[model samples]
Target: MPLLKVVYLSNNTKLYLWKITEDFDMLFSQVKLKDSSLARLESMKSESHQKGFLAVRMLLQHNDYSDFDLFYDEFGKPHLKPQGCSIKDVEISISHSNDFSAIAISDSKVGLDFERLKEKTLRIAPRYMDVSHLKNLSEQEKIKKATVVWGIKESIFKIKNEEGISFLNHIFEEDFSFEDKKATAKLIFNNKEEKFQIQFDSVEDYIFVCAFEDVK
Candidate 1:
């Protein structure tokens, strides 16, 4: 499968998704990886993790990019080098869960997260989010909502890429209904408060979330 979906969140930001249906060898042979990435791939202990990594490369190739053009910072945030003569820097975020891999490219700082819907996430919701938000929801809805909240905090953390930002302590998501398919959240850390615009939806049994820093 090429791309599960392509979403244009704005004129400058786009999201690419891939459903991991191919086996490890199929994905590995479809894209080329740099030496560092190859070594990292070999070091991975799980086949699922390797498949997710290669699926991301597949998404990159779909956008006319290769692994050579991608690099990671010391904090392990993925970034794309200036493509050709373009002077504008492109920001990118990558995430994958059990059955999906997703990448978000934006003209501004962005973060992405993909999580599978499961009771385990909801079971520990109190550790990372406000359980009160889950009140009055059916069991199935609770699982979905909790997973989205987890993704929200994760996406926000990916954007900040700063230390000591605890999901339970610093990140807070405003109450949002599943029907809205969008919401807002805030990060309160180091005496600084920053807001983010959240856009999310469920794909199959998984939830994908993208976070953009609210500059306004």
Candidate 2:
């Protein structure tokens, strides 16, 4: 599928999602990749991973950018090179899980995470999340909510991209109702506190979460 959905997460930020229904060859043929990206793609052992990588490029092309414009930092965070001396840099975040690939672009720093629905997320909820939040939900609801919480932590971690930021110990998600589709979290690490605004939703058995650094 081409560009499954576009989410306007905020006035300055937008999320683009791609459902990876195309075959590897089809996706590979569609996007023009930088030599480094081609080398990295050749290094990937799994077809699924390669496809996810290509689909991200496809999304970039959908938005008028290409792989040549994207790069990574020493911390492994993705960054966009300014198109020209006149164009300002935009914050970008990318994630892929199962059959979906997603990217978020914003004027401010942003983080995005995509997770497939699975029993493991619920089983391991106690390890990283407050299991108390799962108490009143059914088995399926537990899975969905736990997956969201996991994405919340992952999204925040992507934004901070700092060493020793343990999801269980440092990232704290506040109480939120499933119906709200939004929440808040705090990163209490290294004796510094930072706040983030969280937004999440489910898409075809997958969960998409986005975190934006709170402006005070």
Candidate 3:
């Protein structure tokens, strides 16, 4: 169980990260999964994706939940089945990159994304983000920031889970320095505006971003 880190985002929210160090068989034998999850896992075409799926279940069990307590809505958003011992609603978001799997559980609406830093994200930055944000930074710093911004958009999208959201045209992240380790973003779509608070950090060579909807 390579449970890399546990981050307490707030009193009601926490983020869990796992380093996928086990082989597929080892992971499959260790965690319990529901029939639907087993079927879904078998449907994944890649071994890496299957492992990532298993790793998410590992994190859920780490938090005392299981695949049995998780389900997907019509929009494909993941939700936790409420238990009598806990709160009425628990929001969850999950992400996976090449070597890491992450999940954020919160009492409020939240979203999360995990991305591996790469030159492709840097090259494609202009497509989905404000290029001005990458100015005056070294190449390495640019990749880091751009990856975070991309993750920011993805996290917000997971939270909104509505149709017609465009990363390039709809999500806007406010200017912030990398040292801040956090920022804010706005979603403007369908003639409505909503704000989100974003917190991001690096794990090894990957970036993890978490988004929480702003309280009115």
lDDT of 2: 0.92
Which residue pairs show backbone clashes in model 1? none
Give the per-residue lDDT of model 2 (tens digit) for 1-216: 889999999898999999999999999989998799999999999999999999999999998899998989899999887765648787999999878899999989999999999999998887898889888889999999999999999999999999998888999999888789999999999899999999999898999999989998
lDDT of 3 at 200: 91
Q: State the lDDT of candidate 3 residue by residue for 151-210, as single tens digits.
A: 999999999989899999999999989889899999999999999999998888988899
> Where is the poorest 10-residue window by lDDT in model 3?
81-90
Q: Model 1, stretches more than 4 Å misplaced?
A: none
Which parts of model 3 have CA positions greater than 4 angstroms off? none
**Pairs in clash, predicted candidate 3:** none
In the range 20-118, model 1's lDDT, one tens digit per residue, is: 899999999999998999999999999999999999999999999999989888998989988888897689999988878999998899999989889
RMSD of each: 0.9, 1.1, 1.0
